[model samples]
Target chain A: MSHAIVAPVVLPALVAAFVVMAARFDLVLQRTLSIAGTLTLLGLALHLFLLAGDGVPRPYLLGAWPAPFGIVLVLDRLTATMLVLAQVLAIAVLLYAVGGWDRQGRHFHALFQFQLMGVNGAFLTGDIFNLFVFFEVLLIASYGLFLHGAGAARLVAGFKYVTVNLVASTLFLFAVGTIYAVTGTLNMADLAVKSAQLGPEQSGLLRTGVALLLLVFSVKAALVPLHLWLPGTYGVACAPVAALFAIMTKVGAYAILRVHLLVFGGDDLPTAGLAEPWLVPAAIATLLLGTLGLLAARTVQRLAAFSVIASMGTLLLALAMPGPAATAATLYYLLHSTVAAAALFLLADLLAERRGAVRDGIVAAPGFPQLDLLAGGFLLGAVATTGLPPLSGFLGKVWILEVVRAHPAWPWLWTALLVTSLLGLLAFARAGSLLFWKPAALPAPVDPQPQARPVLPLVATGGLLALPVLLALFAGPIGRALEASAAQLHDRRGYVEAVLGPGRSAAMVER
Target chain B: MELLFASGVGVLTAVGVYLCLRARTFPVVLGLSFLSYAVNLFLFASGRLVVARPPIVGPAAPGYTDPLPQALVLTAIVISFGMTALVVVLALRGFLEAGTDHVDGREPDREGRS
Candidate 1:
């Protein structure tokens, strides 16, 4: 019942509204307020993380209403970890945007804050209905952010992103309807209990519902076949917005891990491990698709987009197997991938800005400014992104490989992981050489536009690059923390009891 | 009554999916609207079909429909309305900016030949 449980959701909402109403006319005021709010959110998230690390689920029943009847927000270690990761990324992206990207369109600050609100709410909500609500919130804000620059390419890609997500949202509703019709509940913990006791006649319907839900989440996570919209959308989105979106796919992955491990994972449930059978194969295909995409990508931004997909594939590959060790590895990889992808997006923007008309293309062009510094930054990002040694990406992939070594499909999983890494390495190497090493074959431009690399954007990109390094430096403690969170996620009874009183959970199960 | 409701949902979904696969933005937007309508109806039906029943809790009521799905459907309706509006604006912007209504922002023939 601690009030801090709601701060992550409420604070961002308030800041968003305030920015929209009060600071819309004054760019300086908007920037100041947005930065302050994000920093505050990061601090709050860190506090929540420390609290949640104690392994006790803190459930805040809004309006003093009880669980299963009223809305509740649960703050656990997993939620806190995601919140901190998302907030930290948000601050870095916002700082980069303030370097001039925010002024490209109206209401960028407000939309960014609202996006944070939606993301934080999604992580904290204990009800499926609320999850849908938060998903809509984030989607609406993202639509605005996606079209911020108002370019033809952005508008086109934004349209596709919107249509795809709308369809997925409808599917989500259908799944929720089916679950409600069968179980008469939307609270996740309550459904966990009700789902375990479903009669044979209702099992089929419930299974269909769960499968539909998984499909919806997979689309959001950009699983292959449903991931056609991602590269286009992320590739065309403004740099800072795209950087913020690096966490969006992880939201989908988190939902899959949370719901699958908690609700339908019971031994007696009819639909136990429903996602397991197809998860690994889909993840493998997604990995292959991403690697192929990396090889085929003609632009740095597109390469980064494909790398995001490949990393999601890697995380989900480990997560598909049901065990604490694999889940822990997935969590660690999740953090590494999110940070690395964001840094790559920012770096792509840096490269694009410096290349003048070439603008992030992998082809040779006249260098504009800041060549060595930006090249160095790109090298760091590329190394981390391709899972090179001495970085957290390599550590995360290695950990995942070691943890999943005992699985029946370990051979296929390991092969996919290693091969994709190699492909990614080769792809990045080709891009780096073409972008940084290959001298432009053209004469110096007669009318060169003055280009000055902004300190804020470079600092922002550098800050994000430092994150994976920090993760590598402190791998011992962070890995253990992730393992603990994964253990808590797998302990379904503990979660149900924490949300609902232990006595009520037992009684419900008995009934 | 259940047959009528169920068939309505199925038909709407069918048409929505069909239109959603169209190449143009206008039809796709319309398709999304249709899909949202179908989803809203499906969500409403999840609470079951009941006559002469109030959703509110009362001591003297003979029967009551489930209120949760109604609440959920209402929220879904509002969200979908907002989403539809945004998509309409985005589609309009896309057409105006790209000078084509094709979803891929290019001529269909050009894409096919390429």
Candidate 2:
């Protein structure tokens, strides 16, 4: 691991800290600084990605302390992948901000950059405590962005979003505290090492700690029972902010995948007893509820919000499935859902803006039929979500079924997933019908800025849709990578070895 | 000592959850604030409550409190404060615009109004 590689990860956060101090007249300078910071971070991520391709690992320790002592930053294939995806989305969203860039929203742009910094830091950080800090940074930025514009609706929804997250953050703290109390270390790698020595009772306590951590992440991911804040709040936010948040939910999913699957043991194979046995059923329920919400939704934005919830369910389902195949499916689904949800949300925002209001129903946009231009795109995305053939989503589902087919008890889980995927298709079909097939009376005084629409949103939508298509086309290599990562995830020894090196602690390697 | 603190947190959590389930936005926000306090304390206590010995480094600190949890709790405190302010502002805005603060809002009186 290269020692100097941590500078890029730290620079954006430094810029963000500096940005908070600038005077009003330095607004232009602040935006410039923020943009430059993201660009620099993007460059570093790309550079490290290239390095990973060459089979080099990069680890940077903060404050000159060694790993398991001071904070550490890790740069590997997974971190590189998430970094690239996040930076691309961050840059696209920033460009999209060019449309309504004004002094009133300058703070928003600054905070957006800060949010990106936090996201990148979280992905790169090698320590658990650092992850909490980064999460706080991102959440604070999100609160500002959620309330950036508009009037009462945005504020009301924003309040709910903020309140729920505040509670989640607190729970997150408790989880971290509990873990530290048990393991006597805050470094994730160190915790994994120390935790191995614990007895069954101690392990159970750690499981509770992990469950508490999941509680916060579930709220962030908008799992079924906890998703009430999403629809109304996300439905009314302006287009760019909504698009930005479309990707933010994935952060929670990412946490579940990273912390539970990586930092903690027992989530791996051969330890089905690791987490709760209820996760699968809960995931299936979430999927059904989300799809149902979509079917019942009236407006485009609300439908998209519900779709986000359903996508979360699908990701969870992917996680709950058996073996390497299931892990592979989870990875593919994560990429697919993030892209599709983002594109659909951005498109919904455009449609809403075209209409005077989101309440105007589907008829507001007279060019509803013209959306057929995106029919092929939506169909491809829908097929992936529905687990239909030739799409990555299908490949994922097939893999999961292959792994779990022999287990008689798991049949019901499979059935639930199949049913929900079908329901998802039905929901999308309804959206298609409303947006394309059915028509209603146009509202008075249509938008004047129809033809010369903003170029950034178009680019944003195009970029989001393009990713999954590329993923499908190159599914072979991507699937292989995911399977490999999942195998690494399942076998605790490899992760422990990588983080702690061999022969460091014989008792730690007792597993 | 730890048990008492944990129990207090539990009570705070229960109260917060009950308040959150209420119809009006103000009580919900208050409930959330209380819940956050409970959560913050819970997180702090999760490290198992040692006094006058925070996890920061010093020469005589053989049994220093875990620094990582404290750092995490600090961030949580700051973020929760921001969240509370934002939620309060948002609730005020909604109250002004919709003429009510209940989440459901009488189902918008859709029946006879139109």
Candidate 3:
């Protein structure tokens, strides 16, 4: 059980290495290995999730180097929950890609496995520096995956994405350097303790460090003013890569919860409530921008991309609020939004594939095979994205609305969220109407090309679409678990003790 | 010395940001490299400005500079080096494919109309 903590990080790593070294020329072997690896990870994530049901933070020391010295990977309710979420999405995405998308590029399976390793490591590692390393690992893999098929549009977007991330990475280094210099330890639990004992003089530096860190995460999360790279990147990326990217944004959200909320959350600290003044307002702006962009989007892919930004806004808005109720809402919404966005992107790709010349431009194009079925799928995806009733999106938004009552500016928040949600619905409705409602034959009709049945892609998409419904059905149990996870998240002392052992954290050994 | 070092880092960072905001890809890549150098230097300085001190705990060692920041600096250098290589190749590819060095894949419109 203790060793299972490392499996989520190590398993994909071993598979990724073996796949590259052994199955370099064999796509069949690569697919089989990747599928088997993801399934195993899903099983491991479930087991760990159950293991963490007791709400104890379980730390696995790397090479027994001990916490605050070497890296430690902690498995707790929040970590376990994120693990399960990532693995589930990985399974669906891997299934979606193996159909034919993996054929577009070399090392897709290998890079994907490494991406999993990086994501799992980021979630599991208890040290901030280790988190940065894992972030690079995932990002490097994503860079390859983004440029996988290599086209003019993709190359242009790739340049921007790579440049933006590189800049953010430098900022990350500055933030880490500042933080380590001030705290004398890179271990998160140690920082939590050290930060509490900090003199007021150091608060400014600590705030500067973490604030820079927040800027980096905001780039990843696609928060406004920092979100320019996302639409073009995701919009031009092929569907499977774009679907996989849904989890990447959530990784940023997760970082904020772990580092910003837990490490910097104490009322005793001068930096307490640091994200308060701007986070919600920024989130509101992000929502308005995303929804407006969605309405303005000329292509189905762009529409889905903008919706991702909007859902992130909703998730971050809930996250910025203090209290377990809000955090629980944030977590629930995180699950809903990631899956929903993936489903929407997948459906958009299907539309692109079917409409040969039009290529999912929201113009009226005579659609192709299974048009009605794809339209139905689009309806559900848009419903979940726009927070319509009977799906998890509506439930998630309801939970968020319920939790924000105590917020000092709840009235403004309510107005903005509701108004933007309505705008989001209108945007999707317009997109759905333009794409699905009007079907006019092209000036020169596309010749019917013989194509293989899209059974796998359709099944994979349907499988993704099923999750939002299932989440709503299982809302009772899931809500209870999320509430517990949220409570555990706010209990920073528990985490400190779990990583560093009892009373060890408070003892400042000045080196 | 601290003033000189700090000024160097700040100047590099300022130039880097300015170039990063430019319209073309080459300058952006160069800017990123400059920013990376600035960060690497800043990170190294985080251990404090000490010269010729070994990062060892043994009695033979007179003193030790903080070794962790050096390790971190090495990691940053490697990542930035690899990333810079990637962006250079990507920019070259984008130029060849799109026939434009402009970051947006096309020439800027004089009147800002599509």
For candidate 1, write residues B1-114 as lDDT tens digits.
999999999999999999999999999999998999999999999989998899987999988989888889899999999888889998998999999999988886745841
Write the residue-wise lDDT of candidate 2 on A474-494 in tens digits: 988887776665665565555
TM-score of each: 0.97, 0.86, 0.96
lDDT of 2 by residue, B1-114 (tens): 877887899899899989988778889888988887886786676566788774777887767765555665677778778777877877877788867887653234657331
Tens-digit lDDT string for candidate 3 (B1-114)? 999999999999999999999999999999999999999999999989998888867788888889999999999999999999999999999999999999999988899632
Query: What is each model's TM-score for chain A?
Result: 0.97, 0.88, 0.97
Q: What is the lDDT of residue A93 in candidate 3?
A: 88
DockQ of each: 0.95, 0.52, 0.90
Score residue A434 of candidate 3 by CA lDDT. Answer: 76
After superposing candidate 3, which stretches have Cα over 4 Å from the reference? A440-450, A505-511, B60-62, B109-114
What are the fnat scores of the candidates, in the order listed?
A: 1.00, 0.71, 0.92
Query: Quick one: ranking by TM-score, best first?
Result: 1, 3, 2
Give the alpha carbon lDDT tens digit for every residue of A1-511 in model 1. Answer: 6788899899989999999998889999999999999999999999999999899888899998889999999999999999999999999999999999998989999999999999999999999989999999998999999989789989988999999999999999999999999999999989989987789999999999999999999998999888999999999999999999999999999899878877777767877879988888899999999999999999999999999999988888888876889899999999999999999999889888877778999997766577788888888898899999899999998998898787787888888889899999999999988887775555765676676656999999999999999999999999999999988888787888999887655623321
First chain of model 3: TM-score?
Answer: 0.97
Identify the CAPRI category of the predicted complex in candidate 3. Answer: high
Candidate 2: where is the Cα deviation over 4 Å?
Answer: A1-8, A14-39, A54-57, A101-104, A267-272, A355-360, A363-365, A368-391, A403-410, A438-451, A509-511, B1-11, B39-73, B103-114
What local lDDT does model 3 show for residue A339? Answer: 96
